[model samples]
Target chain A: MIPVDIPLWADLLASLLMITGGALTLIGSLGLLRLPDLFARIHGPTLNNSLGLGSVLLASILIASIQADRLVFQEVLITLFVVATAPVTAMLLMRAGMYRRRADGGKKKAPQPDEST
Target chain B: MTTLLPFAVSFALIAFALAMIFAGIRLLRGPAAEDRVLALDTLYVNSMITALTLGIQFGDRLYFDIALLIALFGFVGSAAMAKFLLRGEVIEP
Candidate 1:
């Protein structure tokens, strides 16, 4: 039950923002499936985490503020929460992956330098 | 305020749902545990966005609270899974 009095420019702007965020999110997950390795796959979600989520949150904040007819920016709190937590999760998951690899005696270490003459 | 927001939310719902499917596929076909964990995390975030889009469509503030709760739990679950992977135990102090 969205209000109908919002300007065309505002609506159009929100639409553009939504589409951009959604597309970025889709691409990020797509990268998860298509990427080669675990570490490489980590890069994909970061795109969605930072820019994708940020843009969509911005659009939501804009629309809600308009609808409420006041300075309602509480959605910014989610943005802040996400921005702060995403990297920490990424870092933790990476360390865990490295731990798993090392425990399995997998390829978690650097190769030795060869000095064959 | 017009058809634009509705259209965008609908499009977002479809697109993000499709993204979730891809993530689900990765989760099921994880060649490594970390990949599975990552897919699950992505799924949580995608679903959160889906809820937010629905909230926007209906102009309901309650959905905001739901989205916030999802974000909180998703973070905790992801962090716990990561911790479990880091150490072999979850509750071991």
Candidate 2:
């Protein structure tokens, strides 16, 4: 990797942002795997959607701006997209999981709910 | 600044990669369908962060586009899958 002429403050700030972002991403994924239930495990990645991605994006913004020597706003597009979409995706997935579980956990004694499209 | 910054970036890259691997393991081993989908969602977001870290590491702006694409597609795919799981088919009257 070629070293660029980034100033001290930019480098320090980027480092801090990256380290925190990476750790939060790891913790979120860990929770996704380790949590006992689907609902609980589903929450593990929200950390990524919120702070994890936020920190990383901030780092990218800082470095990119410094390198380009101007205000670059491309990265903010991703931040906005993630903010708008992550919760909706998670909610729909949770509802699906709950629906499936309810229909399945009926012990097979009761008539199964029709799943025909 | 010189010594610590690069080291920190490298460490962050490795950590994000490790996070992706963890999400992959969960995606493969998750018992429930929705759990797998959730893991898959985590996997893509983790990968996106990895892409962003690459931008920070190598000092390139192109990686930003790549990361953005991943985020867009990952969200669409996951949401569609979740909808399918909910209703058997993604589109209905």
Output the number of the DockQ-best candidate: 1
Listed models, DockQ each: 0.76, 0.74
Q: Which ten residues in a row have the lowest lDDT in candidate 1 chain A?
A: A108-117
Model 2 chain A: lowest-lDDT 10 consecutive positions: A104-113
- Can you write out model 1's per-residue Cα lDDT over A1-117, one digit (the tens) per residue? 777888888899989999998999999999998888787899998877888888888888888999988877888888888888888889888877766664333564622324254
Candidate 2, A1-117: lDDT as tens digits: 525577777777878888898788889888876887786787899998899899989988887777777988788899999999999899998788767776444333223346554
The C-alpha stretches of model 1 lying farther than 4 A from their native spots are A103-117
lDDT of each: 0.84, 0.83
User: What share of the reference contacts survives in each candidate?
Assistant: 0.72, 0.85
Give one digit per residue, the lDDT tens place, for model 1 in B6-87.
Answer: 8887888888999999999999998888889899999989988888888788889888888888888999898888888888
Candidate 2 contains a number of clashing pairs equal to 0
- Mark the 10 consecutive residues where model 2 chain B has the least summed lDDT: B1-10
lDDT, residue B67, model 1: 81
